[model samples]
Target: MSVVNPLVRAEALEARAYQLRIAEEAIKRNTLVVLPTALGKTVIAALVAAHFLYNYRDLKVLVMAPTRPLVLQHRDTFLRLLKLRPDDVQVLTGKYDPEYRLQAWQGKSRIYFATPQVVNNDHSLGMSLKDFSLLIFDECHRARKNYAYTRVAQAYISEAPYPMILGLTASPGADREKIEEISKALYIEHIEARTEEDEDVSPYVNPVAVEWKLVRLPESHRAVERTIRRMLDDRLQRLSAMGVIRKNPKYIFRSDLLEAGEALRVRLEQTPSPEERGPLFAALVLQSSALTLYHALELLESQGPQTLKLFLERIKSSGKAGHRAIVSELVFNGVYRVLESSDLEDHPKVEALEKLVLEQLSSNPSSRIIVFTQYRDTSAYLAARLSKLGVTVVRFVGQADRGQDLGLTQDQQSLLLDRFRSGDIKVLVATSIGEEGLDIPSVDLVVFYEPVPSEIRYIQRKGRTGRRSFGRVVILATEGTLDVNYLVASRRMAERMKKMVKELNSELHPIIRLGPAPEKKPIPADWIARAELPPSSPETAATTFEAELESVEKERRAKFNRELRETARRVLNSVLTAGKNGLPFEELCTELEEEGRNPVAIRSAVERLRAEGQLMKKEGRLFPAGVEAEIPGARRHVFEVLRVQLGEAILRVDDSFNAILLSADYNGPRELLRRGNRFSAISEIYENDKARHVRIYAVEELSD
Candidate 1:
């Protein structure tokens, strides 16, 4: 039987017992629902939302997801199941203007579907959370750290009068600390978790047959790997001899190197004496080069020779002292020559993937397949190679430009997904971006080109298929490499996750009820009363409502403008105070945020200052206008293009360094400004934690 509710469409949603039970528990407390994927977590969210909308007529509902697509998906699902009017539901994303978002928040939209970043930004810019009765955080595992989810949830809890949060995810992860962190961030008091093994869940679960295809590295690839290993060993020995790293070279992993680098950076920050800094600087460089070699080894072993070649070529072209050092050694060891002379164009996994895709298509001609790879390079390679073999395929990656590799825009991504759903595209070669809450229920097969170590990602990837019917999963792992190790680690972590969740469920105390359990109640008749209009005509009421909306919009716009102008003034003053040394954008943000300025306001302020010529960016540092500081010597760095405009592009080397590349300065293709593109460039200016106005003397687009 379907749920019987006036707000929910009749027979639109089947009343599952588990879903209802979970919803009942969720409505009573701030809850975390850790149900497995494809088990209708959204359905449970909808049920809870419907309950609140019925019971608390004056309150609003806020649903937040990590991505724009997920936000839209939730919006559609709610619209489909609820009897709410079209105008009563709204969607907000980064694409929407802040003024429109402000109006939407203040308008009559009781149900809002939004990306967390937008909601967080809006909240920062004076949007109140007090009226929201329920805030549902999708993919709640991301709530940890400084993620937007955590900030939004914290605000909602502190601001909402009778706040109730519903955190949803397929897997919260194996780490107890992380699970607790997510719970604390979301103010979760209870957990409603279900697995496929649960008696209540099994009936609705579709079995997925998983198989592992293990392949060995070719001897030629092994030869290249041996050379890279030797190069890595040389760096490791030097670091060990310098007493920077304690781990034996044989037992060291990438994580250890990262930790060492972080530790060294912290020590460097504390040590001011140049006499002691020389060796530390040298050790830091050696550590970085060692990490690079480790990555190259992984690419060669896990990804194919072509991917490795691309990486090596980028390193060779780089001007960083560490990169140059690594390249010189590679040249001395003849690794580049070996890569150039290799006959292998791709990894063995590519061949295995081709075979699996062909077999799946032959058996089920209308089948849709999702091939998951760890790298965009592999995604591009697989898509290209598969297309050559006459398979309909497309590469699905995140919206970030990396050199020549351009990412799909939201519209492009949505259109491609639509085509894939319509059977126009048979195979989707996707990277990590496709491992999350993408709704593709008709997918017949999921191919993991490489196994990820994260249990959360592993579950999400496997959950892609086996959604609506019995599905097949084929994981391709290279024998005796990180692939095999990662596969085992992920499985172990998944098991540990299930166990931890179970333990938490058993340990968590249920909310004590003074009265009987709350039942779904109908909306009170008095709550439906609108403002009395003295028997006005329908046309008159419509005109009156429009005028009221206009008045509210004008008020919101005025308030927003006042706040933006004030923030801009503060930003300009801050930059002017910094003078020639200038301020790092992030440091400036921290200072303003400490003064209670929201990120949106700060960002708007910065943009306004830049436009008014009150502030200038030099070497990633923000400086006041009219400062004629000499440009520093140019150095090579790989920068990721964050955003592109008509004549200039914003590039980021890391968190501390950012640059602006003007069209006049860049002689490369205009597509270089495509988001997520990475390229080698020489910058003539440098400042600590500051934005640089850079000239791109030489540009080389890194291959995917």
Candidate 2:
């Protein structure tokens, strides 16, 4: 085994021939590297970073991922591989003050790791990208529409003086249109795609034995499914009778319902009179109800009765009557009785999954495994059931908390993944979050709780195994439901994506040819004669030029600071005047900004003060040490509830109320969806603790 680097060797990661070839292509061109998971994608990223560093000592490289965990993962890989100085590499997340991040972007680290959102935000706030010579975008398939990836790519082209891009993903996309969109968005100059089937890759990849574990819905389960379907039909018929939905009620589907609701919402926005909205509002009620019932039917047929029950609980908690009629029908038709049963009879797939898991465990005593499911509720149920079966289990989910679904924080997720890697957790029941770029140790087996139609997700899920050794994968499918359809669609899409990228690679073109769109033709001579104004005097021209230059300078100063140290000094003096009670943290940052220091520079100054022991934090306030008046305990104040109004200014809601913090992302009415707020809008969400420590991992939201 040849050593790849002094820091990273074959034992850490075996650099294969295919990955080396891809890295060679990446360094010379702004290329998209598509390799299957467990194929050293990060190794290629590290290799590319090293090339940029060695070639251009003065330039920096920026590596971005979509989530904090993924960012940290990438940062760790680079740190382990390259022997860089401590300050040479930095990881930036939303937890840092905006000012500190901006400074990092301006120029501080030779190698930087950050989430795309943070990079996007700093760029928007006037941090220049000209200093970054290379940008490595992980999960490059997400670079379409208004996603942060697209915006960053646009800024990189316009702002960077010597820009080179390396877009990385396990799968670029599912279809040709999406792949082309990603290519255009990132201005992908070349595509080097590899899969497990490639000759070079096949030698390194383990043969994963994939099997379809099919099960038929029990009679009782089918009864419940039919009853729910009937109720859904009733709701759709109600909408149809009102002429709100044109589709036949009997054949209406979940996608159709979603499309109809969106259409009605658009129409409602254009209508002027309240009288025209009554029928529309009533139709929306039916639409939401029918959709809820349809989902419940799907859960009953595919997931199991327990998942359906948990889903029902969520619907009732939503407090929207859309699921109310369906719930009532469930009780009337005796479906609720079946739902209350703890038996696996209602969900045959659960029994089949249990048997498969047991068989794998019996065959191999020490095995790591992951079970992928569609819903958080299913994850919870599977974890409970599996634990009862004597399997150590945990539920892994995303950062977006929905209703009773308390999404895992980034730090919490990191810790859980660590435990799983350490064998403290035997099995992980995971939702869509687990399908992303976050790493888990190579598992002996991966079980799909249900088939998913989205090929991107399918590839991610299947790629989890066959990393370290020959792996086994079991997919559970209900005989006659969408599960079968999903399995086929995923296979078809994956094949198509691979074929399209390979074909497109042959006709690769440079990004320069794609950009700086044609300039407008010279104005017609006749039109110029009619519209042109008289030339200005030299004095007048200089005055106009000076005014324009002054405006530009003033704006530039607003976004950056050359006197960050001086501002920090002034901010400290202002807080000292507030005495022992001290100035709130926001007030301190505000004072620094008034002194012309941005968040990035102001934070650096504060850290210097903190390190020197001149600054003290007490009761959510900052003050100089050795002052009078009692130091307020940051923990002394606690509230059970809070009502926060929507506003442009940042609001830090701190209290002892743990429930409010957990349920902050909870939704109510149509207001939550429409009144969009940025992450900084609500700050400092804390969990209730006698420890009095603030929670940094919790992403704050206003659920109430």
User: Per-prediction TM-score, please?
Assistant: 0.75, 0.72
For every model in order, what is the number of clashing pairs?
A: 18, 4
lDDT of 1 by residue, 1-704 (tens): 22335666555687778998998888888899998888999989998898888876777899999888888778767755665654466778988787557656876777899999999898888889988888999999999999999999878867776788899999999999998888878877888888899999999989999999999998768777888899899888888777777878778788888989999999999999999888888889999999999999999888898888888998888888899988988888888888888465567888888899999999999999999988888788889999998989999999999999999888788888889999999999999888888888789999998889999999999999998899999998899999899999999999899888867765555433234333445665443333222257745754665555457546655776787777876876666556556789989899998998766677777776666655667677887553542335656556788888777888887445777777776643354568987655444544434656767544322423
Candidate 2: tens digits of C-alpha lDDT, residues 477-581: 999887898899888999998999999877768766333322223223353243222267745744554454356435444544546556665656655456456
Task: List pairs with backbone clashes in candidate 2.
Answer: 99-599, 99-600, 100-600, 289-322
Top lDDT prediction, candidate number: 1
What is the lDDT for 474 in model 1?
A: 93
Error of 1 at 332 (Å): 1.8
Candidate 1 lDDT score at position 429: 95
Instruction: List where candidate 2 sits over 4 angstroms from the true fold.
Output: 1-13, 236-251, 331-334, 341-346, 402-405, 506-508, 513-567, 571-704
In order, candidate lDDTs are 0.80, 0.72
lDDT of 2 at 309: 84
Any runs in candidate 1 off by more than 4 Å, and if so which? 1-4, 506-704
